[model samples]
Target: FNFLGYNVNVNSLLANPYCKYTECCNDDWIKFRRNRLMRNLTNHVYGQPLLQHAVDALTSHFNPNFQNHKALVLSFHGMTGTGKNYVSNFIADSLYINGVKSKYVHHFIGRLHFPDESKIPQYKEYLYNNLKAAIKDCPRQLFIFDEVDKTPPEVLNSIKPMVDYRDDVDGVNYSEAVFIFLSNIGADVIREHFHDLYFEKGRQREDLQMIDFEFLIQKGAFNEKGGLFHGDIIANSLIDHYIPFLPLQEEHVKKCILNEFQIRNVNLPKPEHVEHVLKFVEWGPDESLLFAKTGCKRLSSKVALLVDKYYRHESRIHNEL
Candidate 1:
């Protein structure tokens, strides 16, 4: 069969592990550079001072000297547009050659994949079998589960055993494997905590640490009405870190606007261009210590409108979408 202009055997491809993980293993293979990932985070990602901790967690977990005690589990909690999904994809891009599209990366959405609560039993079986095969094939596989708060506890049961702190699970070692769970369960709490610290207590954003918001996230995940809180994953302390993403401010939005304009390579955006885009953004926290309601999620569309209105003089190629 011809795949991407190369003839290949489908059976042989499936039989082998998905890209054995290092250049030394295969000269043509992609490798992970700790510096590259750190640089990407430092340059592309904005706001969220707590984000710095992720650099250490990811690098240390994937280190070659690390033991195969169990899989690396990271639970990301925050509001929309807070870089949860963005950071998740960055991790994939940093780890695998094909980035998020890599065959080794498996992404699942709770609402879409599971859906019917009544079918959770079957879903559990299906999830288990799929994961078992993938992990057996490549212990370094990456699994991303989005909308975890919407997923039911019974459905999440499928992943508990594989991610647990067991050295050998039926002869399979998942030390190099990674599991990322993204959810909006603790958005309100995180924002409120930040607001109170900055406004009520007169504490600066830079001074706040993970401890300030972590307990709130833990409280939400444990008490919230979602699959994340319903299971023993938290009680058993299976998750490595509960990474929190705070709300984005107007300055951060301005930076995103500038970055987007730069990426398009059309007419350069001016001060007015940024001001025009900011009008469309929703700010909250009662106008005191304002934060973006949707973070950077709506910037792309708003910027598209900005370009169409003013920069339409610049011709776009037919192939450009």
Candidate 2:
């Protein structure tokens, strides 16, 4: 895909992990940056508790023997369109702007096969060697596996050693990279499989919970003894989880918009522009085409075009009806 006419060879880049990471991984890609963090905190959409916990988790890694903490594993499981991706990006951006170096690696994990596994021992052998090298000089690295549930059992099993501490005789210092797993798995599914319940009713409150079903299954606890389910063990292995809710009042959204405009070096649009954009948002997928067309046009013009097109189309439809 060409990003603003920049010919991007995705396949070749993906093959080169380091190059792929550098190309796509940048703090600016996230909506919230250092310039916007403090302002965002006041207008935080998800409240402060979960965000604070994430900061604490990242900071704790600075301590010695932090490697023993089992790879700062965070599982973000929720319904679609719940800002899981946004919050993850925000966390990554925040750490980066603070001068914390982290190697961000995001993989879809569709089938979870080792990149090169023609020979049985070859893939595992390569992984072990790589892990050893990573340990030699711990560079802050984050391994993000998005849609972990989509990965095949074989691929998931391959990563097990990396997720936990393992002995390496000859290799690098110690693989001290953090592992982050993001999934759209239904909370009710996790609860039923682990907690042996039917559904996840609205709690009216946000507190993170991790129920261990896969652990029980591996330990031979099943049927009457315990909820021995082998379904998605990684979900059970959650080091941390957060439910991000948009608790922002109207004023908060306005503040965020203004802050975003300022940090982006773009002039804030008039009130009418904001109204037009909001209407376009309400229109959803239909307005997506407009954003795609506008590219880097002025925000004011984009909003005006969006409003004009929407009303024009609506008038036509009404006349036809």
Candidate 3:
């Protein structure tokens, strides 16, 4: 008998003298839940049209009949605290069964993994070998490179073959693998573009299209004097998409604080207390800038401090009464 493209010897198993029952094993559906991923992304990620494109790319790549590219390559670029890392976490959690803890997922930090420029060659070999070995074990693997701007250019170029379309490498087909690169490079360009569209051009933030920011970011990353500089990944168009993450505004920061409060199970009777917490968060260098410089990176700690202060104030009042 045949089951789901697999040949099964049902008669042999049934005729076995000691066999009591027969069982069949088939391939597991390793893709993520689309609706769950989309919902979670919408709830967490704010004001970035690139995120929607990311969702579409992921969906298309995971489709069983997709034949365009052998691998999915995504480059996430933006300012710090702008949900770049957050979105990466969301993708991992939504796709893999074990989330970030999955053995099929691999993470590498640029500074931590390859800090010394002198070791670029060694790092490149190591990266290729590790990826080859990992994909050999499981083809449906996800690899994330954080702080990619800090990585050496040579090191970044080493993985071009893996990200590009190819039949096989040493009898191992890695077409099913996914690669994500996160960087703070080209942040200024993104910020400038946002300012131009919203402030100068009188364009609404909601009306901004993915095309508005995509090309400019690609131009910045490819031409910028950094790790991704002079790399064929961008030059040869190996990257499927360059996703830009926008800076967080005050309102968005407030929402983040509220979300943090809910996660920590802290209840504040007065909504004004949330505003009080905002005071603790420092702004960017330029006072003219409306967006938070560090983004929500420091908001959680500030929120904690404010909550502590609020509780202490309550305690003192009760004691006096």
The top-ranked prediction according to TM-score is 1
Stretches of candidate 1 exceeding 4 Å from the true structure: 1-30, 286-289, 312-321
Every candidate's CA RMSD: 6.5, 14.2, 6.6
Model 3 C-alpha lDDT versus the unseen true structure:
0.80
Model 2, 257-304: lDDT tens digits are: 444444333344457745545442221125322111111213344444
* C-alpha lDDT of residue 257 in model 2: 46
Instruction: Write the residue-wise lDDT of candidate 1 on 28-146 in tens digits.
Output: 34356678777878888888778777767877886778675788888999889989999888888888777787777899898999899899899999998898888787677889999
Cα-based lDDT for every prediction: 0.81, 0.43, 0.80
Runs in model 3 lying further than 4 Å from the true structure: 1-29, 267-269, 308-321
193: Cα error in model 2, Å: 17
Ranking, TM-score, top scorer first = 1, 3, 2
User: Which lDDT tens digits does candidate 3 get at residues 139-237?
Assistant: 888899998888888898888888878888778887888899999878999998888788899998778888998889999998887778878788888
Error of 2 at 298 (Å): 16
Q: Which ten residues in a row have the lowest lDDT in candidate 2?
A: 220-229
Model 3 per-residue lDDT at 18: 43
Quote model 3's TM-score.
Answer: 0.86
